[model samples]
Target: MDTQTLIYIFVGGTFALYIGIALWSRAASTKEFYVAGGGVHPVVNGMATAADWMSAASFISMAGLIAFSGYDASVYLMGWTGGYVLLALLLAPYLRKFGQFTVPDFIGTRYYSKTARVVAVICLIFISFTYIAGQMRGVGIVFSRFLDVDITLGVIIGMGIVFIYAVLGGMKGITYTQVAQYCVLIFAYMVPAFFLSFMITGTPIPQIGLGSQVNDGSGMFVLQRLDAVLTDLGFQAYTSGSKSMIDVFCITLALMVGTAGLPHVIVRFFTVPKASDARKSAGWALVFIALLYTTAPAVGAFAMLNFVDDVNETQYSEVDDWFTKWEGYGLTAFQDKNGDGVMQYRPGDAFEGAPDYSGETGPSGERALANTPNPESENEVYVDKDIMVLANPEIANLPPWVIALMAAGGLAAALSTAAGLLLVISSSVSHDLLKSTFAPGISPKQELLAARLAATAAIIVAGYLGIYPPGWVAQVVAFAFGLAAASLFPAIFMGIFSKSMNKEGAIAGMVSGLVFTFVYIAYFKLVAPAANSADNWLLGISPEGIGVIGMVINFAIAIAVSRFTASPPVEIRRLVDSIRVPRGAGDAQGH
Candidate 1:
């Protein structure tokens, strides 16, 4: 069968499976819709959480980021994975014991304030939307390249599939669907990694292959050879660090905290039956995630090496067939700057950024390309880093089935996270904003209808953002993490650890953190956008790292405000005391 037919079959099969599960496990009550009736098994919940946490950014765009950025990408690996540890140890068990339908549910009850709940819902919506937009873009990219559709059409189709399952099954439908997705995605990711590893290093294990000597006559290790290749080509060494340690520390810290604080992820623990289950589920979540995370760096390094060896040094006329194929998709670009057909894939510091369309002649009878038209880089061949994971199979000359599987994997990662995020957006609107606060007299059936409607509306918005994404899918998602770390992490952490924390303090701290981080990011990202590099930042913290500072500000403000306010009621203190232990916890009262 042709490659496109194979992709259609695999991708279509997964969709049918997801829809089948959604129909079979359709949510019957608000409790099932919101938290799967709080009856999910720990291991099952763990796999679901893995699907929830590793979005398009992780599966589709992340390895691409690593392929180009080299060691700088380690920040994402450490930050995202480490945050689960924080969740498992610092937050999950207590929150599970508290037994709430949503983060706002916990925040509202714990702080004894509707104000706190409202603030939290707003933050949750903002963060989820920011994060969801990236997933949508990722869906578009995969569909456009793999299925041969326009990106906008891809976004719409992805939205429809997510809507059918998410609005119908809610958390129950999504949880089981995600288990299937995790299987497809992880398999798709590893098959290529293992294939490429053995092809290059004679090892089936990617981690070992990454550190092993290449099968090529050279005795140097894979990473060592990569570093040598990059330096020789005028780029920084692949294994050496280019970013300041402070930036790495801050970015990693922000991602970790943001992962812990994200509403979609936190709500998964609420699905498990007990506090102990939540703890165990977090451990299992890490294990599933580690499978992909460890393989990613190897996939990235192998792809990079392939690009350097096969594409960079070869003349434009001699370029591989995949090069032209990707160019047809606009994922790769080339311009002969020096009047020589040999493409220069080195440091982009010497010429114009974009292709010059003007017929103006230069001294050497070559077309004179204007320098002002392009500013991103001067390199003659620019490959979109977003294409790395999806393109890896082709780069390594893998089978057509393997390439088709990569498409299915990218779709799985994108759709699974989109479903999870849309559910959070849906619940926040229907449960928190509408039913709980604005119309408390609503019936359970009415609330469920409202949730479905909210989900439908969110799907539309997410689809629109996906088509008209604000930035690179991964960078935009990273911004979401920074926002989450700044706005929600501090508030949630304080709500749990400090019984003395009052509504007034929580509100103040969240507002301060949210506004500061938003403004800082907006000023550089949209208002007066530029590189916004280390030299121009506050304390040398880039927009990516500013969330850590914002987190600090949130903590300081909350602590100061709480000291001057009245402490929690005696009853509230006892509730805190009860949550501190794991033995006496009971089944959560269903919504």
Candidate 2:
């Protein structure tokens, strides 16, 4: 079969599987909807958590970021993985033991104030919505390329699929569906890695392939060869980083804390039966997540090598089929700067802005650009980094089935995380905002209905954001992580660790951290893009790394404010101590 038919088979099959799982596991009660009835096995929940945690950023964009940014992008790998460790050791078990359906629920009960819960809900909404936008955009990219549809129509189709499963199955359906998704996505990711690795380095293991000498007669190791190629093209060496040390540390710290604080991931621990299971599931999730995390660097190196080798200095008439297909989507473009009828891929912008296609073709049959070319730059290409992974198989001439599998995998990764984020948003609205605070007397059935309606609304909003994303997939996700780090991590950490922390302090700290981070990011990202460089940044911290400072501000302000405020009530302090003690620990100690 041809590539298109194969994509139809693979993508259609996966969608069917996801919807069938949703129908089979339709949630019946509020508990089922929110936490999958809290009966999931640790292993199963771990797989589900991996799928939920690995969003479009992880599956579709992280490797692409690594491919382009090289050593500088290592922060994503370190921060996200380290953050999981923080969650597992410091937060997950304790939160699961707290027995709250949502993060807002824990804050509300722990602080003994409705205001604290509402604050957390607001933070959760902001973080989840920002994060979901990237996932929905990933869905659109996959559908646009493989299914040959407009990105807006693709997002609508994705929204419909997620709405059915998310509104029907709730956490119960999403959890099971994610397990299936994990299988599909991991297999899809690894197959190409194995193929490319063996083809380039004669090694099946991507990790080993990354370090092995290339099969080419020159016999240079992968990184060495990549460094040589990039530097020759007037780009920074692939193995060396250009970011300042402080910025790297801050971005990594922010991502770590942000991962721990993400409400969607934290809520996954609640689906388990007990604190022990939460810990167990977290361990299993690390193993599952590592399968992709470890492979990403190798895949990125191979992709960059392949891309440059295939496209750089190639004749426009002889460009690969993948190049033309992607260019048609306006993701890949070229300008004949020297009128050489050849495409040169180099560093820096090719045009003043994003490619503005005028619905016309050039003499060489390439898409004609309306945007003015950058007069000072020699670069003649603009390839969206997001397309690197999806185009990898096509660029390498992998089998039709492999390319099709990539399409399915991308959708699975995007949809799984989107479903998780939507659930978090819906639960915050229905469970925390309505049933807990606004309508404490609401019936369980009514709350369930409300949750479904809330999920439907969230999906619609998420779809809209996906159609018009604020930034690249990984960049947008990084901002969400920063927001989570600033607003939620400190609150949750202090809630469990410090008995003296009061509602007044918690509320104040969250608001201040959130506002500071949001304003800093907006100032550079939206308000003043021209001044976003290192020289203009505060303490030389870019917007992506500023969240670490916001987190510190939260910690400092919460501690300072708590010193003058009343201590938490006696029972609340006792409750804090109780959660700190592991479940059944007293029994194990013969208490």
Candidate 3:
């Protein structure tokens, strides 16, 4: 079939599946809508959670980031997947036993403070919205490439689809749909990778292919060859770290902890039946997540190899047809720096047009090349990393149908995560903000209506921000992780694990952590006075890595303040103790 026909068929099939699941699993009550009736099979819930957590950032962008940035980018792989270990080991079972509908509920009831609940809700809304914005942008980017539509319209189409299932089914609807999405996205991601790996190294497994010797007559493995080639081109080594050791360590830690801390992901554990089941589900979720995570490094290596082979040593006029083709889609660009017919990929700032090759030597003391070699130029090519995933199948010479499936897969990833995030935001506003604080006497039906309203409003805001994303979608999503690590993870961990933690300490820690993280990110990323802002960043630690410091501050403040203030009440202690056991089946009440 033609690419467009296959895309229509694939996307149409996915939509039909989601609608069918939504209709069959339509939530009948508040409990059903909020937590899937609390009876989802552990294995199924684990798959759902994996789908919920991976997001478009993982499926569509992560390998691409690693591909270009090389070994320094291993932080993303380790941090994101390693977090599931922490969640499974430390939080999921207890949180499930707590039987709460949302993270804020646990905070509110455990801390016995409405103010703390509201603050938690505020942090959740900020983190979820910021993360969802990137997912929406990812959806738009994929659709614009495959469907041949404008990015703005793509975001609208994506929002419309999300509105249908998410608004109607809530967590119940999102769960099954996400399971299906996980399958589609993982399949789409691996097929091209497998093909490329086989073609490059005669091995079907990309993981092995990465370490296998290349067929380039060199005895070195693909990693070794890539490292050499990239260094030759003035890029960093492909298999070795490039970023500062501190930044790497800090960012990796933050990402792992932040993944465990994210409210949307944690709430998925509550939908399963037994506390022990939650533990089992978390393991399953990690397994499903590993299907993609383990494949990512191979995909990155394969993609980087493919990209280099496609563009390197080829004349300007001999560039692949894909370049001009993608340029039509506003993805690839080629500006001839020098009038010389041959394009030079070296570091150069004279990109006005063709530079004349004079016989006289230039500053480099060699024959005047067609391009001015500005050894320190940072602007060689500006391909967005987001393009890497969508472009992978095509770049590897895959079939048209494979590319079409990739389009559907990318959209599925973004939409599934969007639905999950929307559920969390809606639940926080309705269950925490309204029922706990403002409308304490509201009916269940009224509360359900409020949840839907909050979800609708959130989708609108997400769509607007999606259309006008502030920065690289992946980087923005990473910032959300940092914020969650700093603000929410510490408080939740202490609330569950620390017997003496009191309301004052939890609230103070959350406030301090939130403020510190916000200021750190804003100064480094948003501030325009480059020199002054650069000077203000602590120890030259980037905002994405500062979450580790913020988390430390939160733990210290919580511990110190708790020592000075009154301990948590007896009832709260009992609740905490109950949450640690496996036989608990009674409801602990939502916010």
Give the best candidate by lDDT: 2
Error of 2 at 442 (Å): 0.8
lDDT tens string, model 3, 239-276? 77756777778888998888888998999988998788
**Candidate 3 residue pairs that clash:** 337-353, 338-354, 338-355, 339-354, 339-355
The top-ranked prediction according to TM-score is 2
- What TM-score does structure 1 among the candidates reach? 0.94
* Model 2: residues with Cα > 4 Å off, grouped in runs: 355-370, 470-476, 584-591
Error of 3 at 36 (Å): 0.8
Kindly report which residue pairs in candidate 2 clash with one another: none
Candidate 3: segments with Cα more than 4 A from true spot: 347-380, 471-475, 528-536, 581-591
> Scored by CA lDDT, what does every candidate get?
0.85, 0.90, 0.80
Candidate 1 Cα RMSD after full superposition onto the native fold (Å): 5.3
Q: Which lDDT tens digits does candidate 2 get at residues 2-87?
A: 99999999999999999999999999999999999999999999999999989888888789889988999899999999999999
lDDT of 3: 0.80
Listed in order, each prediction's TM-score against the native is 0.94, 0.96, 0.92
**C-alpha-based local distance difference test score of model 1:** 0.85
- The TM-score that candidate 3 achieves is 0.92
